[model samples]
Target chain A: MEILETALMQRALIAAVLVGVIAPAVGIYLVQRRQALMGDGIGHVAMTGVGLGFLLSASPVWMATLVAIVGSIAMELIRAYGRTRGDIALAMLFYGGMAGGVLLINLSPTGSNANLSSYLFGSLSTVSEGDLDAIWVLAALVVLVTVGLRRQLFAVSQDEEFARVTGLPVRALNLLVAVTAAVTVTVAMRVVGLLLVSALMVVPVAAAQQITRSFAVTFVLSVVIGTAVTLAGTVTSYYQDVPPGATIVLLAIGVFLVLTVLATPLARRRARALRPERDEHPAAEADGPAVPAMRGPADEARV
Target chain B: MTTTQTESAGQDTNGAKDATTPTVLSLRGATATLGSRPVLRGIDVSLRRGEVVALLGANGSGKSTAVRSVIGQVPLTSGEVTLFGTPLRRFRDWARVGYVPQRTTAASGVPATVREVVSSGRLARTGLLRWPSKADRAAVQRAIDLVGLTDRAKDAVGALSGGQHQRVLIARALAAEPELLIMDEPMAGVDLASQEILAATLRDQVAAGTTVLLVLHELGPLEPLIDRAVVLRDGCVMHDGPPPKAVGQHALPGHDPELLTNQSCHPHAAGEPHRTGLLT
Candidate 1:
């Protein structure tokens, strides 16, 4: 209660709640697309933006946002157009961003290695008035855009090829999602740091997915789980004298583990209930071509 | 089945229908490449309004690519594609078209009820930043009923069988109420019962005058509904005429012995015994 009275703690709490709401909103689509790791890639790339900001004597949060957006878009392009496999392209951006950040910090006279560690592992003490303002503005942008394009985003994430055929402007929507994800990574970095931002984005959504049947319900539930874990983790960190970022992530993981444990039986029951009537219709099942076994001459020749 | 054939044949010769109908889709010398290999090499195919055409071919013969090119999924390296007389690049009336992709096991990983998935099909028609209207809801319900999945509409699609899942996809496409419906291998992994349901559903669509372009491995239950068949061989249109009546025979004119010999070396040729009963 004493810690809650302080302005710094209150600011941190507000930021945490904001991130908790925004990160997983964006994360649901990322998880749906099986691109959960994309958040991590963008977060790593954001470090370079932070380094660049320090070098340019600018606000690191905004710089990180700019760099993250560019990096994310570039990642989308690379995934689409690169000669290499999609994951390989993402790997390139992930490592390159981290390496570039390290090199830039070392080279910049203003960037002290000592201070850089604070950004690496978040320090709640550093959430100044300006940082809070930036977080709110950026968080609002991300949330609004996500809400505004929810249907299109959902359609694209569900089936990109189908979305394109429907004339949903698939490429533009994809870019919008990439940019939103990048913004989410940058905003979340203030509390969780780049190292653990993706955990906040993915874990809650994953937990929500296990229990919820509909995307809308899953989305709303993820925010609830994320906010609860973040607030509880913040309070625990204050009492235990530990890093809030790591505590928040660990708490999320703890909640996830608990949910998984509880969900096992429920999942089993649901699977049993939903299992197709294979026994009753063995002939029909056997009549349909087994997709894997339907390999044509081209596949056979290759083997 | 005989009734379906007679109806399709009658519709085909109805000179009054030809005079009033317009071309819904046209692919003129469309050429495309996937990674350096030419997948669609100078193909020409067209569909008239309310016509049900099947794009058929052996695997690697460019049937999928041709349909993909029409839908703008495959970038054409040369030639032109037009949707309702509008150039592909300039066409923006997407609500007028519905597409069902080939079924894959990769379920979006996000659990959605059948109703919700079907409703997404109406997104284009619903437009952006607005809640669905009464009409939209009614259309979605109608589509669900069309596919005979009204009872399961609230169930998560992940819980459905492969056949039911395919029906949900078809229902989704139907929700749009588009004039043109294009599907890629809609029955590839679907059970016979599901295929019959799909055939009946498509029969209704044909009766309602919807244009359809389907890519299929074999005609199967859909043979009776098809008014025309376009066969592709090595990225070229080998035949464009009546649907082949023989189930297991690749009986197109100018059959290449070399291609047949090459295809025979591969384990699953086009004329396998298992493919017969599904169609005939």
Candidate 2:
């Protein structure tokens, strides 16, 4: 009861909810672009910032977000280099950032007593009102960028090549993606910690995608799931006397597993509900187009 | 969009029954090298207003690259691409140049409706800070109607079939209300009926004063739609005329006559664009 009454727990809960807003909002692009690993990379890099802050005795969120932005840019730049796949590049940064953080911390070693386990694993009892205020500010920035550029982001996410041809500033859009990832990972670092932050962004959005083809639905459902998980996990962790971030991530995983099991039937029912629009199996047949070769060179002139 | 040559072309097209003015799209001495490999060489071709020009090239013939270069996606190694009567660099947004990229699958996979896809075409003209105007909305509706996708306006593009998706892209290009519409391989992977639908839509756009430029493989499917053919080989123009005459043993000028040999040793070796797909 005292824990519930404590000022710190209330602040942490507030912070978690505030940060939760970012996951589903930004996750719309991150999940679809299959850049779930980008969040993972950003999280690892955020850890380095946390370690650096501990060594220098500065604020962790500030330092973590700075490293996170750099790491996000690095991830994008490396992924664009040659045939290096995005996942491979992310993993490189993920491990490299972790190593770099450890090295930086060891070198400075200002606070040998600072327990990194809580930072890596997360601590709901640690958030201050000031921390929550800062999280809200970051969350608001994310909301603005997402709303202002949602259309372009949607168009780009759907087809980056087509987006480029249509004169979208694809390079700028790519940079925005990295920026959003950095922001989300940094804020989320407090709620879900470094290890499971990507899951908070990706899982709910992916679950939302499976339920509907509408971009709006995917987005809305992700927010609902994110909010729900953040709330439920915080309450449950408070009552159960466990680590908040780990419990919340595990709860999210459970939700994902259940959603996956329920998806096919729900999808079929929804499709069947609109039977006239979806003619039997026609929609299914039309789903995936094979990589078709060009038709024979024709005599057709450019019209 | 401020090019000095467009009014002349417009007046010329309006003069007769579907009379085309002079060429607005012209590429000369074009060369492309990707990853240290030559893809195009010394290309020279021009597309006239009211002309539905089919870019025919065997696979690896650099047809897509040629089209991409025309719209400024691919930079020329040593060539000039003129739009409306001036150089491409002079234009700001190239608002008059609408493009449907070669990545059709990517275009169609976006979780949007046909109408939304068409609305994206207006985005270039809309720029960043502004939403689509009523005029833009009407144009989108018109483009969707033109593509005969009004029935499926609300359906997810991902739910569309091969041919329907192509129509969606074409409708998107049309929404820009551009004079020059560049679509890459609009006919690939589509069913016969869908191809027929696309061909009909292309004809409509052309009739409505839009110059259609596309990369095409099978001439037979698009025979009814194309107005002329331009062949590219090794980044150079091989033939420029009607499709039937475009195919022949004649090679591009300024290159060795033997550059037309069917050897992979010189993939970009100048020759006719009809060297078949780069299946080799």
What are the runs in model 1 whose C-alpha is more than 4 Å off?
A270-303, B1-20, B249-280
Q: Which tens-of-lDDT digit does each residue in A228-251 have in candidate 2?
A: 898888888878877888887787
| Each candidate's DockQ | 0.57, 0.34
- Whole-model lDDT, candidate 2? 0.73
Taking the tens digit of each residue's C-alpha lDDT, what string does model 1 give over A1-303?
797799999998998889889999999899999888889999889989888988888888888899999999999888767775877778888999998888888778889777677777777778999989988888899889878788788888998887776677788888988999998888889888898989999999998878878888888989999999888878887789889999999988888888888887886666567637522444767888456756556632332
Q: Backbone clashes per model, in order?
A: 0, 28
TM-score of 1: 0.87
DockQ of candidate 2 is: 0.34
What docking grade does candidate 1 earn? medium
lDDT of 1 at B37: 70
| Residue A18's lDDT in candidate 2 | 73
Instruction: At residue B133, give the lDDT of candidate 1.
Output: 91
Candidate 1: pairs in clash: none
